[model samples]
Target: MITWLTIIGMGVITYAIRLAPIVLLERFALSPALRQALKFVPVAVLSAIILPELIMPGGGVDVSLANGRLLAGLLAIFVAWRTKNVLWTIVVGMVALWLL
Candidate 1:
Protein backbone atom coordinates (compact mmCIF):
# COMPACT_ATOMS: atom_id res chain seq x y z
CA MET A 1 0.00 0.00 0.00
CA ILE A 2 2.71 2.45 0.97
CA THR A 3 4.72 1.74 -2.19
CA TRP A 4 1.69 2.32 -4.40
CA LEU A 5 0.85 5.52 -2.57
CA THR A 6 4.43 6.74 -2.96
CA ILE A 7 4.36 5.99 -6.68
CA ILE A 8 1.07 7.84 -7.11
CA GLY A 9 2.41 10.82 -5.15
CA MET A 10 5.55 10.89 -7.31
CA GLY A 11 3.46 10.79 -10.50
CA VAL A 12 1.38 13.74 -9.36
CA ILE A 13 4.49 15.67 -8.35
CA THR A 14 6.17 15.01 -11.68
CA TYR A 15 3.08 16.09 -13.58
CA ALA A 16 2.82 19.28 -11.58
CA ILE A 17 6.52 20.03 -12.08
CA ARG A 18 6.20 19.75 -15.86
CA LEU A 19 2.82 21.51 -16.05
CA ALA A 20 3.81 24.49 -13.92
CA PRO A 21 6.29 25.84 -16.47
CA ILE A 22 3.76 25.80 -19.33
CA VAL A 23 1.04 27.28 -17.16
CA LEU A 24 3.24 30.11 -15.94
CA LEU A 25 4.88 30.83 -19.29
CA GLU A 26 1.55 31.03 -21.11
CA ARG A 27 0.81 34.38 -19.47
CA PHE A 28 3.88 36.10 -20.84
CA ALA A 29 4.70 37.09 -24.41
CA LEU A 30 8.25 36.25 -25.31
CA SER A 31 10.35 38.73 -27.32
CA PRO A 32 11.20 37.97 -30.95
CA ALA A 33 14.90 37.52 -30.20
CA LEU A 34 14.17 35.19 -27.33
CA ARG A 35 11.76 33.18 -29.48
CA GLN A 36 14.32 32.93 -32.24
CA ALA A 37 16.97 31.82 -29.79
CA LEU A 38 14.63 29.21 -28.41
CA LYS A 39 14.57 27.59 -31.87
CA PHE A 40 18.20 26.64 -31.42
CA VAL A 41 17.80 25.32 -27.89
CA PRO A 42 16.85 21.80 -28.96
CA VAL A 43 19.79 21.51 -31.31
CA ALA A 44 22.20 22.91 -28.75
CA VAL A 45 20.90 20.66 -26.01
CA LEU A 46 21.04 17.61 -28.26
CA SER A 47 24.62 18.41 -29.28
CA ALA A 48 25.67 18.91 -25.68
CA ILE A 49 24.16 15.56 -24.74
CA ILE A 50 25.33 13.57 -27.80
CA LEU A 51 28.77 15.02 -28.60
CA PRO A 52 30.41 13.64 -25.48
CA GLU A 53 29.19 10.11 -26.13
CA LEU A 54 30.42 10.15 -29.71
CA ILE A 55 33.78 11.73 -28.88
CA MET A 56 34.37 9.69 -25.75
CA PRO A 57 32.78 6.29 -26.09
CA GLY A 58 35.42 4.88 -23.66
CA GLY A 59 35.20 7.84 -21.23
CA GLY A 60 38.23 9.44 -22.86
CA VAL A 61 38.43 11.86 -25.77
CA ASP A 62 39.08 10.11 -29.08
CA VAL A 63 38.85 12.09 -32.30
CA SER A 64 40.80 9.69 -34.46
CA LEU A 65 39.46 7.82 -37.48
CA ALA A 66 39.67 4.67 -35.35
CA ASN A 67 36.73 5.95 -33.29
CA GLY A 68 33.71 4.37 -34.90
CA ARG A 69 31.17 6.58 -33.19
CA LEU A 70 32.91 9.76 -34.22
CA LEU A 71 33.20 8.51 -37.78
CA ALA A 72 29.57 7.46 -37.87
CA GLY A 73 28.48 10.77 -36.39
CA LEU A 74 30.38 12.63 -39.09
CA LEU A 75 28.70 10.55 -41.76
CA ALA A 76 25.32 11.16 -40.16
CA ILE A 77 25.96 14.89 -40.15
CA PHE A 78 26.84 14.77 -43.82
CA VAL A 79 23.76 12.75 -44.65
CA ALA A 80 21.57 15.13 -42.70
CA TRP A 81 23.13 18.11 -44.42
CA ARG A 82 22.84 16.76 -47.93
CA THR A 83 19.58 14.86 -47.70
CA LYS A 84 17.80 16.86 -45.02
CA ASN A 85 16.17 13.61 -43.98
CA VAL A 86 16.24 12.46 -40.38
CA LEU A 87 15.41 8.85 -41.27
CA TRP A 88 18.24 8.51 -43.75
CA THR A 89 20.72 10.09 -41.35
CA ILE A 90 19.82 7.69 -38.59
CA VAL A 91 19.83 4.64 -40.87
CA VAL A 92 23.16 5.57 -42.42
CA GLY A 93 24.71 6.35 -39.08
CA MET A 94 23.62 3.06 -37.56
CA VAL A 95 24.79 1.13 -40.62
CA ALA A 96 28.12 2.95 -40.63
CA LEU A 97 28.58 2.23 -36.96
CA TRP A 98 27.79 -1.46 -37.51
CA LEU A 99 30.23 -1.69 -40.40
CA LEU A 100 32.95 0.18 -38.50
Candidate 2:
Protein backbone atom coordinates (compact mmCIF):
# COMPACT_ATOMS: atom_id res chain seq x y z
CA MET A 1 0.00 0.00 0.00
CA ILE A 2 2.76 2.41 0.86
CA THR A 3 4.56 1.72 -2.42
CA TRP A 4 1.35 2.23 -4.37
CA LEU A 5 0.68 5.49 -2.60
CA THR A 6 4.24 6.66 -3.25
CA ILE A 7 3.99 5.78 -6.94
CA ILE A 8 0.67 7.61 -7.30
CA GLY A 9 2.02 10.66 -5.51
CA MET A 10 5.10 10.72 -7.70
CA GLY A 11 3.01 10.33 -10.85
CA VAL A 12 0.80 13.27 -9.87
CA ILE A 13 3.85 15.43 -9.13
CA THR A 14 5.54 14.47 -12.41
CA TYR A 15 2.36 15.16 -14.40
CA ALA A 16 1.94 18.54 -12.78
CA ILE A 17 5.56 19.48 -13.46
CA ARG A 18 5.25 18.59 -17.15
CA LEU A 19 1.81 20.17 -17.48
CA ALA A 20 2.93 23.48 -16.00
CA PRO A 21 5.42 24.07 -18.79
CA ILE A 22 2.87 23.51 -21.59
CA VAL A 23 0.23 25.58 -19.82
CA LEU A 24 2.61 28.46 -19.29
CA LEU A 25 4.04 28.29 -22.80
CA GLU A 26 0.59 28.43 -24.34
CA ARG A 27 -0.07 31.83 -22.81
CA PHE A 28 2.98 33.50 -24.32
CA ALA A 29 4.56 33.51 -27.72
CA LEU A 30 8.16 32.38 -27.91
CA SER A 31 10.85 34.13 -29.92
CA PRO A 32 11.77 32.81 -33.37
CA ALA A 33 15.24 31.90 -32.24
CA LEU A 34 13.94 30.07 -29.20
CA ARG A 35 11.44 28.13 -31.28
CA GLN A 36 14.19 27.10 -33.70
CA ALA A 37 16.42 26.02 -30.81
CA LEU A 38 13.61 23.98 -29.28
CA LYS A 39 13.41 21.87 -32.45
CA PHE A 40 16.80 20.35 -31.62
CA VAL A 41 15.85 19.45 -28.06
CA PRO A 42 14.53 15.98 -28.92
CA VAL A 43 17.59 15.12 -30.99
CA ALA A 44 19.94 16.35 -28.29
CA VAL A 45 18.07 14.50 -25.55
CA LEU A 46 17.96 11.27 -27.57
CA SER A 47 21.66 11.44 -28.36
CA ALA A 48 22.44 12.06 -24.70
CA ILE A 49 20.50 8.94 -23.75
CA ILE A 50 21.43 6.61 -26.65
CA LEU A 51 25.08 7.40 -27.36
CA PRO A 52 26.25 6.28 -23.95
CA GLU A 53 24.27 3.04 -24.11
CA LEU A 54 25.66 2.21 -27.55
CA ILE A 55 29.25 3.03 -26.70
CA MET A 56 29.09 1.36 -23.31
CA PRO A 57 26.53 -1.41 -23.41
CA GLY A 58 28.09 -3.30 -20.47
CA GLY A 59 28.27 -0.24 -18.21
CA GLY A 60 31.89 0.24 -19.20
CA VAL A 61 33.27 2.18 -22.17
CA ASP A 62 33.92 -0.20 -25.05
CA VAL A 63 34.72 1.34 -28.43
CA SER A 64 36.36 -1.71 -29.94
CA LEU A 65 35.10 -3.82 -32.86
CA ALA A 66 33.75 -6.44 -30.44
CA ASN A 67 31.00 -4.13 -29.18
CA GLY A 68 27.89 -5.14 -31.09
CA ARG A 69 25.90 -2.15 -29.92
CA LEU A 70 28.58 0.29 -31.01
CA LEU A 71 28.85 -1.39 -34.39
CA ALA A 72 25.08 -1.44 -34.83
CA GLY A 73 24.80 2.19 -33.82
CA LEU A 74 27.44 3.18 -36.35
CA LEU A 75 25.60 1.26 -39.06
CA ALA A 76 22.33 2.90 -38.00
CA ILE A 77 23.96 6.30 -38.22
CA PHE A 78 25.13 5.51 -41.73
CA VAL A 79 21.70 4.26 -42.74
CA ALA A 80 20.00 7.32 -41.31
CA TRP A 81 22.47 9.57 -43.08
CA ARG A 82 22.24 7.86 -46.44
CA THR A 83 18.55 6.94 -46.55
CA LYS A 84 17.17 9.59 -44.22
CA ASN A 85 14.42 7.15 -43.23
CA VAL A 86 13.75 6.38 -39.61
CA LEU A 87 12.09 3.02 -40.24
CA TRP A 88 14.94 1.77 -42.37
CA THR A 89 17.50 2.96 -39.85
CA ILE A 90 15.79 1.08 -37.01
CA VAL A 91 15.34 -2.08 -39.07
CA VAL A 92 18.92 -2.12 -40.24
CA GLY A 93 20.24 -1.40 -36.77
CA MET A 94 18.25 -4.20 -35.15
CA VAL A 95 19.19 -6.67 -37.86
CA ALA A 96 22.84 -5.73 -37.59
CA LEU A 97 22.78 -6.20 -33.83
CA TRP A 98 21.01 -9.55 -34.09
CA LEU A 99 23.34 -10.88 -36.76
CA LEU A 100 26.46 -9.68 -34.99
Q: Write the per-residue lDDT of candidate 2 for residues 1-100, one digit (tens) a residue.
A: 9999999999999898678768888765678998999899999999999999899999999999999999999999999999999999999999999999
Q: How far out, in Å, is residue 70 in model 1?
A: 0.5
Cα displacement (angstroms), candidate 2, residue 15, comes to 7.9
* CA lDDT, candidate 2, residue 1: 100
- In model 1, residue pairs whose N, Cα or C atoms come closer than 3 Å (at least 3 residues apart or on different chains), thus clashing, are none
* Model 1 lDDT per residue over 1-100, tens place: 9999999999999898678768888765678998899999999999998899899999999999999999999999999999999999999999999999
Tell me the lDDT of candidate 2: 0.94
Predicted candidate 1: what Cα RMSD to the true structure? 4.5
The list of candidate 2 runs beyond 4 A from truth reads: 1-26
Evaluate residue 42 in candidate 2 and report its C-alpha lDDT on the 0 to 100 scale. Answer: 93
lDDT (CA) per prediction:
0.94, 0.94
Residue 27 alpha-carbon offset, candidate 2, angstroms: 3.8
Off by over 4 Å in 1: 1-26
